[model samples]
Target: MIGKTFSHYKILEKLGEGGMGVVYLAEDSKLERKVAIKFLPRHFATHSDEWERFKIEAKAAAALNHPNIATIHAIEEVNDEIFIVMEYIDGQELKEKISKGPITIEESIKIAIQITEGLNAAHEKDIVHRDIKSSNIMITEKGKVKIMDFGLAKIRGGVQLTKEQSALGTAAYMSPEQARGEPTDHGADIWAFG
Candidate 1:
């Protein structure tokens, strides 16, 4: 995708890949800003259910605005290629920090507080972030925490999106109720936070 122009955005380089799709660093020529674009995999795009969920992810996160949360810029489809444009965050995944070594108590407390604050904002909007693992949390170079990937989030009062007991979150961070394949709520996030 390098050098390819999707809409007004020019693909620059690859950021990473996940189960949902590959993320790339792109330049928004219209706005003259760098953005992160996550493209839905062609295989998954062919699947209707996953496609729907992909759209839902954009909606679910687009409604939220918090410093501790990554911002959603736009969801676009160019030539059957669906992608999400998001705030380009230059940071390291929280999981990597932990793996490198133990963090200072002060830094740990700050990160926890930021995560809690971000979750509080989501819960206030009746959104339940079903996944809250370390990898899903980002620590910016300036020491700011930003929660990302609301792809598995469940909006309260919305239609059930996933199968019961399918365990959408990482096993180590999943709540017990989620593990049992039962319905969950904000409490599940709190459990993961603990």
Candidate 2:
């Protein structure tokens, strides 16, 4: 989809793909700025459950306005293709950095602080980010920590999407309650954070 235009955003290149969707770097013609667009995989697009989960992700993230959390610009659909436009973050995943070597204690503290702040904001809004792993955290060139991906987020009082007994987050990072497919609250986030 490189060089293809979707509405006002022109796809520049593929950024990455996750269980939820494929992300692409795009240029917004209207805003004259770069944006990241996430498209639900075609295979999952035809599934109502997956579509609902995708929409929930957009809704959950869009409701938050925090510097440490990647900003959601817009959710759009064109020719039956649904995608979410987000602030283009120029950075590497935390996972990639950790793979290099151990970070300095001071640096780790800073990153942890920023992540906690972001999580606080989400929790204040009653949004529990069930998936909180290194891969979902981005570290910009400026050392800013921005949390990404809310595909498994659970918004309080929101519609139930996942099936019973189905655990939904990265296994390695999931809280015990999450791994067991039990009901979780903000405490679950604390466990994962720890």
Scored by TM-score, the top model is 2
Return the TM-score for candidate 2, rounded to 2 decimals: 0.97
Model 2, 81-122: lDDT tens digits are 799999899999999999999999999999999999999999
lDDT score for residue 62 of model 1: 94
- The Cα error of candidate 1 at residue 152, in Å, is 0.5
lDDT of 1 by residue, 1-194 (tens): 98899999999999888767889999999999999999999988888889888888889899999999999999999988999999999999999989999999999999999999999999999889888889889999899999988878888888677766577777787899888878889998999889
**Candidate 1 TM-score over all chains jointly:** 0.95
What TM-scores do the predictions have?
Answer: 0.95, 0.97
Clashes (backbone N, CA, C under 3 Å), per candidate, total 1, 0
- Report clash pairs, candidate 2: none
